[model samples]
Target: MADDFNSQRATLSCFEENKPVFDSFKVNIGKGGLGHGLGEVEFAHSPLEPLKQEGDNKAPIGVFTLDAVFGYEEDIKIKMPYLYATKDLICVDDSESSFYNQILKTPKVMPKSFEEMRRDDAQYELGIVVGHNKEQIRKAGSCIFLHVESSEDAPTAGCTSMKLEDIQKIVSWLDKSKNPILIQITKSQKDEVLKLYPMLKLEE
Candidate 1:
């Protein structure tokens, strides 16, 4: 109910420098693997997406942040304590979850509770957090992230998907000063977003 995120009809360029920043992105809504921009990715960033399955078809347009990180110590080292396989976790604001992406107020970490959630597996393997709290964008919510893709061909949920090598490369290069990974929509949505939040417009 709390939707504080920027919509596609609001902005254009979402980068701070004229560099080859963002690794890869989705265009042509609902397209997986790859897509070409109608004109160009005016913005250097991208937006968070809704949860997705391998064959599902839908691509949302909204601005988002890679708020925090999570995963393994040997591989994905999210700076925060958003550990998976623990009992005290939940993806609170999700329509996909019968639990709706919300972790229970009661704290108890259990992996069995998540036995049926293979879609959420990506959150653990990769250290990419998402902006799924459409209920509010401050990020005070539940389970979400851009974890390492299960299969290179695996479709993503709202969160952006990338390879382990890609994630590691991007994370290392990303300016911690820019803590959040900005996911901008394509040209049409970019323009639409700019119309709404003129102040947040990205500079080309």
Candidate 2:
């Protein structure tokens, strides 16, 4: 009899400033409390500056919890709770607004200083919410997510983007019961991770 929680945990890691166009990430599955490399994905920016502010365009370098999975499809299947981003759904980025960094479904009426979750482009066709700065820390960044890349070589606005197929695989691979977490790292933090958890493998 084995505990499923410890075995199913997944870690998504990325190195700081790894690439000029897009950063690379590796997704691994935890087995017997050790991380087994599952596959690789691309993220944007190594994030030189802190990610606690808007317009940084730098992906946060730290561990964040996977909150929710969203897609435009009506019946998309995934390991976590899924939501369909309607045309009226938006995430408030206004630091002053009480709803800052919060997603709201406001049908028929558009709000100012908000980001529409539903977009004409396919970049957000499917996205996974990253619980970064979830406390709504003013000016500490907002609307961070793991989503699809518009172009294979283009960078994202402080988000981890991947190919549609890859994102789908990641969403499917996640296990909610395991408390799956994403540990986005940088060059500086690499040694710390390796020192703390040698079981986790890092690939170039």
Candidate 3:
């Protein structure tokens, strides 16, 4: 987790059957920091903290499912369901549209606002769909994913990002049958998170 709600960088670790699968790695989060999101569990946030919004640029804080894998490639060898991010594929971000927070092919439905799944940069070359706000809550947050970082290793608009090799490793390791999930939170919320998921061995 980040040191605080305002931090854009944090350490990420992977585990399998309560054993470390790989050494902890660094990752870049939302440029605007972190905020409460719709996830597997709800967390109590201070009045000062903000809830995730459509364009807040804040990474969601809570447990979320790793729904699928997406990339610019036509096909991938990953075990999870893969999405080929074709030129026509877009993720709707328009809260007013019926397809809010959904990924769809263009021309079939046009929303006022949406993000192209296929990008010119390498950021979207490989990515994982994070199951945040699956209920399509208006302005709650949308199109969240675990994707490759930019060339500069800069922060994302809201998605979590890491080195291409690192993200690829994660994507390859993920198994749909395992029902993989992501737990994201600040250090201050560690104790509470432990109470809910005691199996986690988070560092002090």
Candidate 4:
């Protein structure tokens, strides 16, 4: 978890059946830090911290499913459901549009605003879709993912990012049958988070 809401970096650990998959690695989060988001577990809104909103640059804080794997490639070897990010593919962020939070082929349904899945950068060359605000919660944040970091290792708009190799490793290791989920929270909220997910045990 991040040190706090304003933090841009955090240590990420992977486990399968409670067994460590690898040593923890560092990852970059949203530039604005973490904010409460719609997820498997609900957190009480704190006046001190903000709730997740579109373009907030805050990574959502809670448990979320790893829905799918997407890339610019036509096909990938990963087991998760794969999506080819064609040049015309876009993830709609315009809350007012019917396609809000949905990834669709361009021109078929044009939203006022959207993010191109196929980018000139390598960051979107490989990515895993994070099921944040899956219910299409308007302005509650959208298009979250675990993707490759920028060349500068900079923080993302709201997605989690890391070294390309690290992201590749994670993508290869993920199994849809296992129902993998990401649990993100600050250190201070560890105990509370564990209580909600009794099966999860973090190192002291």
Give TM-scores for every candidate, taking all chains together and pairing residue i with residue i: 0.50, 0.73, 0.97, 0.95
- Residue 125 lDDT in model 1? 56
Best by TM-score: 3
Worst 10 residues of 4 by lDDT: 195-204
For model 4, how does the per-residue alpha-carbon lDDT over 1-204 read when each residue is reduced to its tens digit?
A: 889888898889898877779888889999999999888887665688778899999999988999999998899888799999999989999998888888778866478999999998898989998888988988898899999899545898999999989988999999998899998887867888777766765754
Error of 3 at 87 (Å): 0.3
The residue-level lDDT of candidate 4 at 83 comes to: 90
Model 2 bad stretches (over 4 Å): 1-51, 107-111
Query: Stretches of candidate 1 above 4 Å error?
Result: 1-18, 22-59, 74-88, 93-123, 134-144, 193-204
The runs of at least 3 residues in candidate 4 whose Cα sits more than 4 Å from the true structure, single-residue gaps closed, are none
TM-score for candidate 3, residues paired by index = 0.97
lDDT of 3 by residue, 1-204 (tens): 889999899889898877788889889999999999999988988889888999999999999999999998898787899999999999999999999998889856589999999998888999999999999999999999999998545999999999999998899899999999998989988988989878988865
The top-ranked prediction according to lDDT is 3
lDDT of 2 by residue, 113-199 (tens): 888888999988988888877778777778878888777545556676667877876777676776666665544456655675566
Better of 2 and 4 by TM-score: 4
Error of 3 at 191 (Å): 1.0
List of clashing residue pairs for candidate 4: none
Pick by TM-score: 3 or 4, better one: 3
